[model samples]
Target chain A: MSGSLLITFDKVWKSYGQGEATVHALAGVDLAIRSGEFVAIMGPSGSGKSTAMNIIGCLDTPTAGTYSFMGIDAGRLDRNRRAMLRNLYVGFVFQGYNLLPRTTAVENVELPLIYRGAAARERHDLAMKALAEVGLVGREHHTPAELSGGQQQRVAIARAIVTRPTLLVADEPTGNLDTARTHEIMELLTRLNTELGLTIAMVTHEADVAAYAERTIRFLDGHVASDAVNLEVAQP
Target chain B: MIWETVRLSLLSVRRNVLRSFLTLLGIVIGVAAVIAMLTIGSGTTEKVKADISKLGSNLLVVRPGRPAGPGGPGGLDQATNPLGSKELAALVAHLSGARAISPASQKQVRVIFGTESLTSGVTGTDSAYLDARDWKLVSGRPFSDSEIRSGTGVCLIGETVRQQFFGAGDPEGEIIRVNRTSCKIVGLLEPKGYTGFGQDQDNVVLMPLAAYQRRIAGNRDIDSIYVAADDRTPTTELLPRVEDILRDARRIPPDREDDFSIRDMTQIADAMASATTTMTGMLGAVAGVSLLVGGIGIMNIMLVSVTERTREIGIRLAIGAHEKHILIQFLVEATVLSLLGGIIGILIGLALAGLASLTLAIPFAPSLAVILLAVGFSALIGMVFGFFPALRGARLDPIDALRHE
Candidate 1:
């Protein structure tokens, strides 16, 4: 919480290929965020919001310039070390709620812990705590298909936070939900933000979704178009 | 982690129970085919070896023919003596490793015992001939040397002949007749099962060599001579010396071919073993084609699995799984499937081999090494076929995968 900047993007650029036919995924973007901040990236389709989130999450690296997280140069880590960093430092929630279909809710939450070789009882305890945090205490046995859309997303969010990573990235967490479920998901995410002091980065095309965060960044054609604090924020 | 993948794969199989069972059927058939082919092949080989051993170890048969005179080559029969007596005597005298040699000259004649008469062989041979044919005295003893020298009225009876005359239990010292002449049955031979050529083994009688030379047939000429070699002398070390002595005795020039033939045990064994091994290999190759088809089945199932689990893979990769994790997961799944089939096949194969052996009345020989080899080979097939689809699954773009409808 005391750090000046938890993440720094110094003119980062990303391209899919080498030639004229290359896709300019993230074109010369520059940004920084301090610890304990909840930010939303707002953009239209093909506007590079997902690319920025991907680089910030350490799932991908920039093609040029530098991106640093917690002042440890990100690009310097090898492929395996980068993976280790992602496992240790970041958690992601995708739009699809990608909770392994055959797995129960608690088992989905335990996925990251399993990868780190946590003992069974310890992982189960942690996963139970995560499920309880998302108000899924009695629903541990439910699979993704067995739960409602918002409940499934909450299980996914529980999974994202089970490892207690410093950074949480959610991409369109409520895209599949109705308005009521969307509001519930928004409230849950915001509570995780202000209450747990987690540094959050999210991408959404909805204005209401962007208004739920303390800060919002706008992207257009692979560049940050605007950065502003929310004047009329929606609280959970 | 691999075990977890296997558990999940098993769970998935349970979820699609029918499809999974169908997929495994191919592997079952493939493994069963391999095991069955190997079992039958080895069983047949054992049967052949037993039949050959029944012919007697380290003995060769010499027949009078130029291979049955195929294109009317006008080859001679047993009367012509393609294997000569002089050469056989030389084999007994000069060959470094030979034990004895005796000629066979028989004229079909009526063998009588009181009023119980039968038409049977009147073959003539020396004492060494009986040893070459693996016969032993069941009662009394073989004809004496004096009897052989005098061409006396003494003969050795086989169990069959004695049983027909004396009803088996007490035929040791009995009397029989040959060509209407009374001869004393001085000995009875031990019972033997059957010949390599399927003739009844207990249907023969032995007469003194000089007795046959003088009494059985009027002509002084002999037909084929059976030669016996010492057991310690390998055929490789004996054939050339015997051939040289026989060549000298037959009065053939250095460059001219002799009018006789000689064969040995080692060549026959080598030839039979090689032919059987080759036939097994060829049959195994045919069975292997079904294994490849089973591999294709694995590939198809794996491709379907990858396509169906794309979103799960995307989430796993997003959550920190590297490409290798996904690869190992699917590879292990496929291997488990193949190994299950292998185990089932092994049990069935052993059962099948047992049944065949019981029916054929031969020894049941199941090698654990061969079973394990088949299992390992099937697992290898799974890995080879499953790798490509697993790579495709591991490399899917998370964004596109998550977005897949």
Candidate 2:
């Protein structure tokens, strides 16, 4: 079900400091991901995977190359403009779940919609739908501290999808979960990809977590080491 | 959005109750002091005006001696000619705008009736004295012109004298001894209360001018003259005429300052009121210094709050909050805090002023304008002091703030 390209990175470079102390986080990276595709990014430490993911989510801009999102040169935009782009199209699921502590799961899910300036009632209904989609119907009132780790991750995913974004950028979404919880989370994400056609780009060091994606791209020393497709999972 | 921001700010303020109260203390004390000082000052002004008006309205007091100066004794020079019958006679004869002109000589004298005795102010004045001083008698009649001329031993007893010698009983037709001479109380003076300077105006006796001069003061020297202006004649217009007439009667040359000073009660009232106003303003300015210090305290606490909530700010930023949104939230929080302090301070200040008014016997004059100004000022202080810290929080990089532990 792959469609037209939605994200592209051409010779993207991100560096820190200046001159002799410069450290390149992403160097000469070239990548493309199309709509309805679930792509997994894998790398060792300091292999530029996180930096590439950050650029794709518009949380950061490329230091020296072009980053195009849905035909717009997003890397050239200012901080506020990129923030608007992220709010409109990109939803993020971090490894830490990143649900605000002491906040209820529904409230946490309603956060992105709040930034979108949706009316309170509409935001609540949409957040409730998103939570139900993540299988967190009766747990809407439970705070992040009260919820289990997997449930908290589900709440974070609900927050990411509350605005019905086109792209979901998950950075090691199941890194903090155990094996069974991880399987459940990966399965829910797979159902979302197939049913809603939500484009997903995930970063992970775990091999099994990367196995859920339709395509896999590996980074080593700030460059893509390989790009391949999984031939299995056609039945599942 | 603003309502939402205000609600959020109020929630945050409520979360740290003790810290918010501590931050509010400076503003509270400042506003309290300002309110109390202004309220008491206005009350004092009102009391002073009332005291002067009690002396007389549209009236002037002509006293012997040049006006008091820094280099000279304050209106106590005994060498200058005393205002006497001659000046009184000239004013009565030639002054057209004067409604009444009367001369008075006064002394502290011991008066005795039955077994009771009290030391009271005794004054000798003509029948026109009551008209000139705007005084009224509650019972009996003023002295006849024959009594004023013939040095008759008749008098009017004031409220304090009647209370001491008669005890709620009418003092009219009662005989009281003044000094060594006996006099009949022909009238009861109305209760005039006390002057602003705490002098009991009711503890006095009034008698015929000839009787007081002959029996009590033992001299023909008149102490002062009261001149009341008629309606339609402004005191300003009558003042120059009185000066000219007095100058002519005293035979003073055009170049030399007159030996007698004439005081307009209205002018004195204005001066005293304005003096109190100036004092109030100065005290308010001093209290305003504390408000500034309070503002600094707010800034300090807001800075700490920003640091403590850096991660929260980071999350808000990552979720697409604008810099202005973060700034407005903290600003609203500070404003709410200080406004609460200001309101509390106003109530406390009013209480203090009420207590002062009770003890000092002045009017309770709480000005709504002053209260409103204080409220507006505290809000401004919050906005002014809360700005830098709010900006500091707003300008933080989302990544760096998120990374902050």
Candidate with maximal DockQ: 2
Candidate 1, clashing residue pairs? none
Instruction: Give per-residue CA lDDT, model 1, range B28-55, as digits (tens).
Output: 7777777777777777677667666555
Q: DockQ of all candidates, in order?
A: 0.38, 0.41
Q: List runs of model 1 lying over 4 Å from the truth.
A: A1-4, A9-32, A62-66, A73-79, A138-142, A206-211, A218-228, A231-235, B1-43, B65-130, B135-224, B235-257, B282-308, B334-362, B379-397
- TM-score for the first chain of model 2? 0.97
Clashing pairs in 2: none
Could you tell me the TM-score of chain B in model 1? Answer: 0.76
Worst 10 residues of 1 chain B by lDDT: B61-70
lDDT of 1 by residue, A141-236 (tens): 988889998999999999999989889999988889999999999989888887888888998889998899888999999899999999989967
Model 2 local distance difference test score: 0.89
Per-model clash counts, in order, read: 0, 0
Highest lDDT scorer? 2
